[model samples]
Target: MISDLFAKIRRAFGDYAVDKRLLQEAEISKLPGFVAEYLMTEFSMNYPSDWLERLRDFVKRHYFEASEKEYVKHMLVERRKIAIIDELRIWVDLEAGEHRGIIPTIGEVDVRVPADLARKYQMAMITGMWGLIELEYSPDTAKRGPNGELLENPVVVVGFKPFQAPTSDPEILRDARQYFTLDEWLDVLLNTVGYNHSAYQTVEKKLAVLSRLLPIVEENTHLAEFGPKATGKTFIFRNVSRYTRIIVGGMISPAALFYNLRTGIPGEVAVRDAVVFDEISKVRFPNPDEIVAKLKDFMESGQYERGKQRVTSGCSIVMLGNVEVEEREGAYVPVEDFTYILPKPMRDSALIDRIHGVIPGWVLPKIRQARYHLSQGFGIALDYFSEAMHTMRKESLVGEMSKHIEVAGNITIRDERAIKKMMSAFIKILFPNLYFDNRELEIVAEFVVEMRQRVRDWLHKLSPGEFPKDTISVTVRS
Candidate 1:
C-alpha cells in the first residue's frame, strides 16, 4: 500500500519527486537538502548510469570545508582561478567603491564581484545565495590603503550559477494537494521534509511535527516551541529552506537581527523569510532593552527602524528551546512555565504577548536512524518545496476565516488575529483550493485556536493580572 502511494506521488510530481535515500547514499548530509537534491537530480538527468559517482566527485571537488580555506586560497593564487560551490553573499563597500563577496567555506570576505553580477542576483547581496562561483586572483586589482598597505583580497567573482528552483509556482503544489487525501497529504509533507511517514503512528502527532512549518508558510507569524532535546526542532529549519536563518546559542545583537548601522546592510530578519532562535534559553541579547524593544515592534507590526533605515519585512520569528518534560499518565508534559525557557530579554510579558502561537514540542518523538525516522519514499524536491512556500507568503487566505468561521467568548484582538493567521496558513497548506466543507474548516479552526490558546495560557501563568484566564472559542458558520 505504501509503495503504491509512493508511486502515485512520483507520477504526480514527476521530476519534482526525488528519492530521499539518494541524499544519504551520496553522503551529502552536510549540504542543505534543497541544494543536495538539486545536484542529485541535475547529475542524474545529465549522467545516467554513473550519476552517483559523478555527483560524489562534483561535491568533493567544489564543496570545501573550513579547514581547506587556506588550500583553496593557495589554489586560487597558484592557478590564478578556481571554481567552488558555496553560499555566496555580496555586500557593497561604499568606501572602496566595489562589490565584495563573502564565501563562507573559503573564509574569504573581501572577494570582489562584478557590478553586473551583483545587479543580476540582488538576493545574494541581501540574504546570500548558494551557487557555483568562479573566482580569479588578480594582484593588480587589489586595493591599497592611504598608507600603501594591501587593504583587501585580490580574488574576484568571474562567474556564478545559482542553485535554485527553475520556477516557483505554489499553484503546482496546490493543484497536487487536491489529488491526495488529507492523510496522504500529511505523509507527503512528512516525506518532503525527509521523514518516514509510516514511522509516525497518529494524525495528531503528524500535525504536531507539521506545526514547525507554520512560521515558514505564514507571513509575520511569531511562534515558540519548547520541549525535551532532540525533537528535530532545528533540523527542519536548517535543511528545509534556504530562506530561513538559524542563530544557535550566542549573543544576538540588534545589528545582526535588524540592521547593521555601520555596514548599511539589512540583517537576517529583513532578508530571510523566517529567523529561528535555536536554543533560545542560551541566546543572549547584548542590549536587552534596545533589542527587545525593537523585537516587540517587529513581531507586532513587522516594522523596525535602525539608524536611518526604516524597513518592513514579512519575516516570521520562531523560538526553539529545550525544557524539562515529565511523563504523566503515559504522556510527556512540560513541568515548568514555557516562558522560563526563553532568555531573560525575551521573557517580557509585552514581548511574550506578541507571540501568535506556542507549539507543544513535547508531543513530537525523538528522531532516530534505527526507528526509520528518515524518509525512503519519494518526496518533493526541497528546492521546489522551499520556493513554493516562499511564494505562498505573497498570498493571504485570512479572509476565508471571516467568510466561514466565527469567534466566540472573550478573545483578545491579538488572539483573534493569531488564530486567523494560523488557520489561514493551515488552509493554504492543506486546502489551497478553498473547497473545504464546514467539517474540515471546523477541525482546522479548533487546531489553530488551541495553538493560540497555548500562548494565552502561558501569559496567564506569567502575568495573571495583565492576562487573565480567557477561553478562545471558534465555530464554523452554519
Candidate 2:
C-alpha cells in the first residue's frame, strides 16, 4: 500500500522530471549525485550577460532551472533588472536513525576555473536561477599519483552532513486516537514546523488568537520570510509545505523578484506561492526609492508592474528579521511601523492600515530543541487544509469574541480587515473546536489586542526614546 501510495504521489508531483529513477536503475545513487550533475550540466548554462548591447533574457531564467541552494541579488537598470548571484553550499547534519533532529550548517564550495566560469556562477546566484553549493577546491591542478601523472582517482574524499527531517511523533499519533478534530492536526503542524508552545511567550500571549494561520496554502504565487535571524520566522514558511517555496537571504531585488525587460521578459519566482522576507531589516538596495515603491503597492493592492507588464500577483508576503534588541523581553519591531514603516513605500498610512497582522517576533523566544514532536493525530498534510480553510476564512474567518467577551470600550480597530484577521487567526490557532463562551472570548480578545499593541510598542522602541506616552491603552478588560 505504501509503495502504491508513493507511486501515486510520484506521478502527482512529477518527481520523475528530475530523472532519479534512471540513477536508481543502476544502484540507487544518492540524491545529491543527481542534484549536483543536474546543476552542473543543466544549470551551469546560465550566466552574467554581456554589457555590449541588449541584455540576454536567458540569464534570468537560469534561476528556476537550477536546483535549490542558489541565492539571487537584484540588478536593476533602466527599468530592466537582472538578478545576479552566487550559489550557496548548504551543509546539514542529522541524527542518522530516526532523523528527528536537523542540524543546518551554512557554507559554500568554490570551483574556480579561470575568470570566465566565476562570472557564470555569479550570474546564477544573482538571478535566483540556481543554488551555489559549498565547495573547497583549488583549480590549479588535480592530484598526481607516484609517477608525475594526474591520479586516476582524482575525486577528493569529502564527508558532508545533510539536512535532517524530523520524525513524526509516535505519541502525537497516539493522542489522535482520542479525537478526530482539526485542533489535533494543528498540534501536529505546530510541532512539525518547530513551534514549541512551552518556550515562547508568543503562544501564551496570543492563546487568544492561535488558530488564524492554519489551513493549507493552495495558491501558486510566492511566500517571502524576512525577519531578524533566528526568530523561527523562516521556519513556518520553509518547513510547512512540500510545494511551498522559500527564498532565504542575500540579494533580493526587483529583478530577482519581478522581471528585467532589457531582453525577453523573465518571470518572478513568487508569482505563484508565498514570498518570505528573511532578515528583512537587512533588505538594502543601492536605491531604496524603486524597491520601496514596489513593496507598498504589492502589499496593499497586490499589484506589481514591471517594464510594460502589469501583473496582479497573488502571494502572502511575510517579512521577518531581527530588530536591534536592547531590552530583555521587548518587542523586536514597532506597531506604528508595522505596515507603514516596514519599507519606505509601505510607510503610507493608507497602505499600512491594510496589513493583516504584524506578528511580534521580538516577543517570540528563540527556538531550542533537538527535534520537534507534534501532538498526536495531527494531520501532516496541513498545507492542503490551509488552502481549504482560506476559502472558508473569507466568510467564516470573522472574530466571534464579542459574543462571549466584551471589548474594553477602549479597544478600537482602525482596520476592520486586521480585526477580522486577528479573530480568524485566533480561531485557527484554537481550532478543532472553536465554540467559546464570553470568558474564553475575553481571553482571546486580550491576545488579539496585545499582539497588535506589542508590535506597535516595539516599533516605538526602535526610535530613540520614542516610547508611547500612554502605550498600554487597550487593556484587555475581561
Candidate 3:
C-alpha cells in the first residue's frame, strides 16, 4: 500500500538493493529521497557485498576516510580513481586569480580548467557552483601560497557539466490540485524536508514545521530560530536546495557575505537563494558592529554596498543556534535569560527588529529515533521543488494578504513590513495556486502575524527601553 502511494513518483533506483540492516542502522530512510538515494548509491558502490559484516568491522577499526587523512585525495590523477567524484565544487581564489575544485569527503585540489571549458561554464565557475568535472589530477607540488606554504596538488579539468535546476510546467502548478489533494501536496512538501505527516498530528504543528520552509520559498527574507538542539533547524537549508549555502562555523567577513572589493564580484548574498548561518553564536566576525550594521541594512532593504559597487540580492538570510530552555509549569523558560543566544553585538534591538519572523524552536520536538520521518510517500524532487520555489519568489503575493489584514496602529513601519513579508512567504508555500477562500486566508494571515509577533515580543522583552510597550497585533477585517 505504501509502495502504491509513491509508485508514480519513485525513480528507477538501480539494481543494487540497499542493505536493509545498514539502512536501519544509518537511518537513511529518515532523510529526503534525494539524500537517501545518494547515500544508498554511494554505500553500495564503496562497501563490500558482505557490507553488514564489513561495515561492523570497519566501524570497530574506526576507519573513516574523512579522519584518516588530514587532506585526503578524493580526486586522483589516475583515470579509474578520478571517477569517484560525482559532483565537485570549484572554488575561485579572487586574490590569486586561481581556481580549485573540492571533492566532498576530501579536501581541496588545485584546479586548472581549459580556457574553452572556463568560457563555456563561466557563470557557474564565477559563482563557485557544483558540477560533474572530468579532471586530470597529479600529486606534484604545483604552487605555493603567499606565505610560502605548499598548496595541495592541482587537477586540470578536461570537461564538465554544471547542474541545472529542473523547469516546472506552468500548467502543472496551475492544476496541481487536480493531481493531488491539499493534504497530499502538504505531505509532499513536508517530505521534501524529511518530515513524516504522521509526526505532526495538528494543523498548527504542521504550519510551524512549514514556517521553517518559508525562507526557501521567499526572497529577501530574514528569519531566525533559537531553541533546543537537534530540532533539524538547519537541515532543510543544508540538504533540500543547491540554491542555498550554509556556513557551519567560522568567521564571516563583509566581503564574503556581500561583495569582495578586490575581486569586483558579488558574494553569497548576491547569488544564493537562502544563506543559513548555522550555530549563530559560533560564527565570529572581524568587525562585529560593522557586519551587524550592514546585515541590518541589507535585511531591511534587500540591498547592500561594498567598496564602490552597490550590490542587491534576493537571498533570504536565516540564523540557527541552540539555546538552553527548560519546562516550568507547562511553559518554556529560557535558562540563559536572554531573548536570543546570538553574538553580543548582534543582540541589539535594531538588528532584532529587522528579523521578519522567529520560530519558537523550543516548541519543536527534539529529533529522536521516533521523530525521524523515513517516509514511503511521494514528493517532488529536491531540485525541482527548489526551482519551483525560486520561480514562485518572483510573484508578488504580499498584496493577497495585505488586502484583508491590518496591523495594530502601535506597530512600527518596519513591523508592518516584516509581517507582510512573512505573510507573502507563507502564501507562496501553503497556497501556491492561490485557491484559498477568505476563511483560509484569515487563518494564514493570523499564522504569519503570530510568527512576527513572536519576534517582536522577544525584542520588547529584551529591550523594553528601546521597543514600545504596546505589542503588535494583527486584525483581520471582515
Candidate 4:
C-alpha cells in the first residue's frame, strides 16, 4: 500500500515542505515520501507521490478533529504568509513608553448611508455596548447591470438590548488608562453590542468564550447561526474585532460574497474577513446548495470553486442559536427532542457532518437588569489580538492533543496518544501555564463529545421519524 510510502515522503519532505511550483510534476521523481510513508503505516490516507497530496487528497480524507488533526489539516492548506510583525511596526508609532490603553479604530461611514440601517445602529448604540442590532439590506445593494435595473429592496433591522448599566455616566472614559486590563478592554469591544453586565466580572467568567471564539474568528468566512432567539448572537460581529465585517441579512445576494459588485470590485463576502449570518433560520436559501455544497468543499478541501475562479478563502465559522423547547416540564417533547427547531438547511445529514462545532446556546444566562455594571477597570485591544492570533495559527506551532491519537478504524480516536494530545493542547489554550485538575480535563473531554454528538444526532434525525433519543450516528465504535 502507498500508505507507508506516503508517510515516508511526508517525514522526509517535512510533510509538504516545498513550494507549490516544485510540488507539481509530470513524474513521481520530485517528491519526498517520508510523511507519505508515515500515513500509510497509520491511517490508510494515500496519494500520488508525484503531486502534493495536500492538493490531491481532497477525496481521500474529509473529516478533521478539532484537536490536533484539525491543526494538522490547517497546516496542509497553508495560508498565504504575511509579515505580521512588520505590520505591527506601524502601531509602534502610537506607543509612548510602557504602553497605555489603545484607542478603538473606527471605520468612517460612507457618504451615502442607508437610513433604515443607520437608525437601527443609533438605537442599538444607546444601549452603550451591550445591545445587538442586526439589519437586513435590500438585494439591490448587491446588483450589477447595465446601469438601471429594478431589484428587490427589503431592509429590516432587529434590535436585542442586553442588560447594561442605565446611566451613560460614561465615567470609564475619563481616563481609560487607570482602570482596565488588556483582556477586559477586548471583551468590551466584543460584547459591546450585548446586554450590559459588569465588564470586570462577566469578562472573567467569559474568558473561556474568548479562547473558544479566537481560533474560529481567525478562520472567518461564511457562517450562519439559527435557533431560538435571545442568545446575544450578533454581539461579536459588530464590535468584537476588525477581522469580522458584517452586513445585514435581508440584503444578502449570492454575488455579494462571490462575484463582482456594482463598482466592479469583488463583493465584500467574496473576500470577507468573516461573514456571520445571524437569525439564519429566517434566511431563505434561493439555491440551498450555494453555501452548503461549497461549504462541504471548503471544509474538506480548503478551496472554494465558483466559475473559472478558484479562491482559497480560509475561514473558520461559528453558528449560534437557542434550542426550541420551552423550559416548561409538562410538554410531550422535552425541549431536547424537538427537532423542528433546527434550521431547515441544516437538516441534511451530510451537511451536518461537515460542521466542526455547534456550541449550545442554552447554557448562557439571559441578560437581566440587575446584572448590569456601570464601569470597569480593564479591557483588551481586540484588533491586535484578532490579527495576532491569525498570524499564530498560520505557524502550525500551537500544541494540540489529537496529534497522538490514532484514527484507524471507523474514524474515531483509537489512539490513546491522540486523546492525550487533545486534552493537553486544549488545556494549554485555556489554562496556559496554570495548573488544572483532572476534573477540568474530564469536563473538556465531555464537551468535545457533546459537540460531536450534536452534529450526529441532527444527522440521524434527517432520515425521518423516531431516531433513538440518545444514540448518535457515528462510525466510531469507541
Q: Rate the local accuracy (lDDT) of all candidates.
A: 0.86, 0.38, 0.65, 0.36
Q: Which stretches of candidate 1 lie over 4 Å from their true place?
A: 145-147
Top-lDDT candidate index: 1
| TM-scores vs. true structure, each candidate | 0.96, 0.48, 0.79, 0.48
Best by TM-score: 1
Which stretches of candidate 2 lie above 4 Å from their native place?
Answer: 1-189, 196-229, 242-245, 259-270, 326-354, 371-379, 382-396, 399-414, 432-434, 455-478
Of candidates 3 and 1, the better by TM-score: 1
Error of 4 at 137 (Å): 26
- Residue 385 error, candidate 4, Å: 2.9
lDDT of 3 by residue, 318-427 (tens): 98888899899975655774344787778888888888887777766777763355433545555455567767877756777678688885888878888887888877
Pairwise lDDT winner, candidates 2 and 4? 2
Cα lDDT tens digits, model 1, 211-240, are: 888888999988888888888888789988
Error of 3 at 316 (Å): 1.4
Report the C-alpha lDDT of model 2 over 1-478, residue by residue, as the tens digit: 3233233333432311222222222121222222322332232234324321111232233323233332321212122222222222211112211111111111222222223333333323222222322232322255466877853222211222122112222232333223423333333334323343334334342332132242223222112222344555655454443223345545566775766554223344333345666655455565566666776667666687877877665555555555544354544543233333254444444333334445554544554442332111112333232233334433444445334433343233543334445565555445435544455555555556555554444434544344342333223233
- The true-versus-predicted C-alpha distance at residue 450 of model 2, in Å, is 2.1
RMSD per candidate (Å) reads 1.7, 16.7, 5.7, 23.6
Scored against the true structure, residue 176 in model 4 reaches a CA lDDT of 38
Query: Candidate 4, residue 383: CA error in Å?
Result: 3.6
| lDDT, candidate 1, at 121 | 96
